[model samples]
Target: MTDQTRISVGLQFGTQPPLNTLRAFLLGARAMTLDSVMVIDHFQNVFPTSIWDRDLTWLAAQRDTPHEFFDYQVLAGYLASRVGRMRLGVGVTEAIRRHPVLIAQAMMTLSHLTARAPILGIGAGERMNLDPYGFDAAEPVSRLEEALQIIHLCFSTQGPIDFCGRHFQLHSAPMDLKPARGRVPEIWVAAHGPRMLSLAGRWGDGWYPATVVSPREYAEKLAAVRAAAVAAGRNPAAITPALHRFMVVAPSEREARAMLDTKVVRAFALMAPPSLWRQAGVDHPFGERFNPLVDFVPGRYDRETMNAAIAAVPSAVVAEGPLLWGSRNQVVARLRAFGEAGLRHVVLAPVSGLVSPRAALYSLWATGRIARSLRRTSPGDGTSAPLLC
Candidate 1:
């Protein structure tokens, strides 16, 4: 593995934190000089209710209630105005919920507002966001493929568009707005499966996969992406390899483990299919019980049930998964391993107690420390500097 590589570090802002907490974290990140900030695009709460409250009866009562989530585009614009230096973007938005033209226009607007082209991360539809809203969740990959094509046309083409696909169609669609930076925002695609990986290689400027993927798995998938890029006649090096994972920085290993044992983290792990757990070498207790294919419901379980299920799993098993939790040095070492494994970008999603103001501030400080350590120890003989994007 060559160490003469550059890595961009990003922080992910999701619905788990309240708006105030998110604002504080962003301000702290800017003060600490982190590279970029990305926000998740979700109409509903992706975090389990247990994370917010531990009381079983209270959780059950609020299970049917809507969760708080800000619109990502609007939030990105807001954050951009507040934090002028840090690159702002939506970690990912689904093509199913919003049209390609609108997404393109929104990104362009963000670019003009921020004075830099924001990263537009996209993915196929997730059932959690689609099913309740009555959007067609079928053939998500097909819809995503067509959506990518349309989005590309909207960004690159000069005149009106006329496209007809199985899932979406456009007839003389007007896309008159040009990007403020003289180019559209870089499109990053979140993909896990083989088909989606190929699409990322062929069309995306960056490839993003969930953090549960092991470093070895990331290497394999990245190889596949490079092959697909070569087959498509695009420069493979142009596609940035980005990984999104939850992180917790603590003073000791035990404290880190305790933080990862929260109901939210356990429930999040349970939502991953058993195959992914096995791939990550996680010995999860809920084998095939909450498989997305069989369960069909988004999240699969409510707070009480998920809490019970997570309680049965061993902490060691959870520790073995993709979460980055440890002392400062340990966290830095793990990140170095990932960089060695061909990861060019990493987006850290702080979990559990780290979402709190005090812990989040500490995490930001630790992140600055880690970023400096990576740069100092990075294998290149002090000649090539890693780009902070």
Candidate 2:
């Protein structure tokens, strides 16, 4: 593929930064002239809510914490109304938490408010979000598949929607609200595994994967999506290949590395299982001895214990993981590798000492630099090229 392949770069609003801080961050991002902005969907904090109830010390420590989460749909709508140019989206909303019909309606509302079709990113479900809310987490893939059908129907068809599925049933469900100018918002499916990849290719307009993926693995998964699209009689090139990456950028490599080697980053690295690391061609130091992916449940452990566990993770492992951390040129080279791997879009989540504004601004600056470089070198191949926006 030529540089005519347009790469859409955006920022992912993490699970921290209260509404005011978030709004300021968005303003700063807009000033930097980014392409799009995405917020995450979570009913509670990204951390396990059980932690507050189970650990008094953690609760006490949080008495003055500014780490708060806003509903992504609401945030998206608000941002759409305020931000003049940038596209707005939710990183990934679960089908289990909200019915697909409602999800469609929400997207329609956002589209109308923004005067442009927004992207609707969907995923199966996460146990952390589901189990705590008393929702059944079993058979998530099947439920998500059914939900996708319902959502597609709602967006494509007019009048009453009627559907019957294992997890959901709708009888003449009236979904009259349409997207702006009849432009249906793109449904970007967040998928990683084989089945989800197939689902994304078959039904979704885009494939949105997490930051844990390696460049090689991303190419492999993108190929799977393409093959599935071909098998489904759809154009493989039509589906957008997108990634959500955690990024830390600073003027100096030492500063960036210092920000990256923290408890939160370590915990995030440990959350991925060894099998996943091996799949990405990294040899995880702690194999079965520490399986946070399978064993660590949020709210089950105290903050002290969790910190201890995160501290035990080898710094080398965190350094070698999926995170993008370095000076501007280093980050650009890493991102270019993903671009060569056929990634058409990137959503970055800036990580720092509890979502510090200084770190966020540095990241936005770095991202702007990357976006400019991509656009400048982009060849005129008679195809739409990436825009900085």
Candidate 3:
């Protein structure tokens, strides 16, 4: 484990782009001195219906939709060729959507091509995609555990993997590809629950958690994850803890707030549990009768209605907490908190809009500033390296 307060930053795609958007992220990440770049693996767009129309053009150009033959494996190959040094990975591939053998194969190919720069981030599959295929989302913990074991076996051995599990079975199917780099590619498991955390502790090289808002929350989760790793007979501290924060960095807090209003609020309204808003002491703008995620009919959103819906939730409750937003200084201050909490990396996920023109520029600017700040600080030597990887 590194002793420095190492900050390995990266970005996840927010929309389909014209290649230039990706170029911007790649360049921005480089400028910021970040260590990794990633993309989420999903067959379909994961946005609310209301925003789909506005998002389709970008999405189509950026990725192959779910069930489509054109997939990330192809894109990753091309990306690996073009981008150098910054580690690349699927932020997470759904465990139920593909077999571990296939996942390992793709990872191995990318690893070979990129000189073992690709890191594998796997998670339990989403029901929206797997249920149609007769897969059970209810068994995510068990399923993810099985998938990890299988993928590990395939990657580490020359002979075929032979194993049978409740969710998966592999027999004499060896992974023939060898990584060009001597080191095997790193395996990361994205998890938020204790059960999955235990699994990560035992097998994962890294742990990726969803949008972390505060240093307190980040520290708490790390504690649990490391504890689980220790209990599983692994060195908890060896595992790298990374956070993916929905960020909107600006010159000032006011502009960031407005961006949050127009973009973040609407975007989250579609994916986050509405109950979270209620926890913030806010009412559901669409009324208890309406689910904002219902199939969106394009050109149907009434501006007044939408604005009111967004306003129904308080900014303090909705945008600020559990998210990184505001001026450059503010974001830097918070990031330092994360460093103090024993985090090794933080992925700044700009709002979909921010990942574009206005926000992209700021994000690029902030990256450099942040990387410098982290380099100046030293992660203390209070703890021994525990295997959290």
Candidate 4:
């Protein structure tokens, strides 16, 4: 398959201190056929104090604090020096913290550093990143729409920008910076809901959803994105369909299932909102509308609170759609299914690595093998090549 038709797989990881582990992982990854490397941007981590301590003990040992998220842009610039021709991007950054102008400037600067065009993953503000710093988090989606417009204007407009919107007002704001060698950064929107999906088609060059869903459900979401793009008079196929999900791999499906039952793995279910827990006949300790991804404040919950929430997470979630895990062949088959659903790009990270040091090594090895198999096969095609394992 040609570049445009071939499947693209990327990695998403944090760039905190003790870069040796991450750099080692990337050194091994350099031999793989990865298309991109994405770093997450967040002022605060989602995990509470106790859960973080128990899971990421290595990081905890190195730092005074359990949660330490280095600035993504600074780390991305550093990473550019370490990586090869792979694309670089923040997996998803809030449009609220930094003004659109600043984000545009940062992207432009990084564009000169990387071999390929960089990506700017924009998403509506999350509470942990917003409410703590006292930034205005009200009407986040609406704010993000205005931010997208201003960012576009900053990159596309030749002269100063003069625009007014409900959230921001720019009076001839001068942003005359040009792209490095005409390589404009692509904006991939991390959209989930209907309105956010519409915004993605209207402004985004790619659609990136982190939620784990069946291939049919993914196709449905992609259809909505395409429909919205067509309504906006844009070429629907030009928008890349991407997914970001967590994984846990083992030699067999049963082993993978057992790995999923660990305390670290089960805690991931807390990332889902309470509304989802209710579907499984479980009550969220935080209440019906509580969503940790959106509303969780780091260092807020004690051990008991976290344990209560983790206990409330039914076994069904571990054996369910969101967290992808299985044997190598099963994982390849699942990814092939997603490819058939119009998934051109995917970013997966191993959640089971949090279990132990041995599990971490296996996770890296298995993930590398998975990346190789996908790159060799013609995904989205009816047939798949033999599993690499």
Query: What TM-score against the true fold does each predicted structure earn?
Result: 0.86, 0.86, 0.81, 0.92
Of the candidates numbered 1 and 4, which has the greater TM-score value?
4
**Per-residue CA lDDT of candidate 3, range 150-175, in tens?**
88887777776789899888778767
Q: Is candidate 2 or 4 superior in TM-score? A: 4
Q: Write the per-residue lDDT of candidate 4 for residues 1-389, one digit (tens) a residue.
A: 43443457787777666778668767756666577888888876767666666454444545666467788888888887767878888889977889888899999888888888899998997888888788998999999999999988987899889989998899988998866876789999988889989998999999998764578778898899999999999999999999887888887777887887777777777776544566678666677777666787866788888877777778775566467788876787787777777888888777777777777778778777777767764546322433211
| Global lDDT scores for all candidate models | 0.72, 0.72, 0.65, 0.78
lDDT of 2 by residue, 1-389 (tens): 35555566887775454567678778876876777788888655435433333222223253343225677777777788876688788888888888888898899888888855688998876665677678777888889899989888877788898998899999998888778885578889988778999999999899998744467878999999999989999999999888887776778777877765655556667665465556555444444554543234475566666566666666655676666777766666666677888888888776642445476567767777766655555533222422110
Off by over 4 Å in 2: 15-17, 47-67, 276-296, 353-357, 378-389
Using TM-score as the measure, the top candidate is: 4
- The pairs that clash in candidate 4 are none
Error at 142, model 4, angstroms: 0.7
Global Cα lDDT for candidate 1: 0.72
Pairs with steric clashes in candidate 1: none
lDDT of 4: 0.78
- The regions of model 4 sitting more than 4 angstroms off are 1-6, 55-64, 273-275, 378-389
Candidate 1's error at 93, in angstroms? 0.8
Model 1 CA deviation exceeding 4 Å by range:
1-3, 15-19, 48-66, 279-300, 314-316, 354-358, 379-389
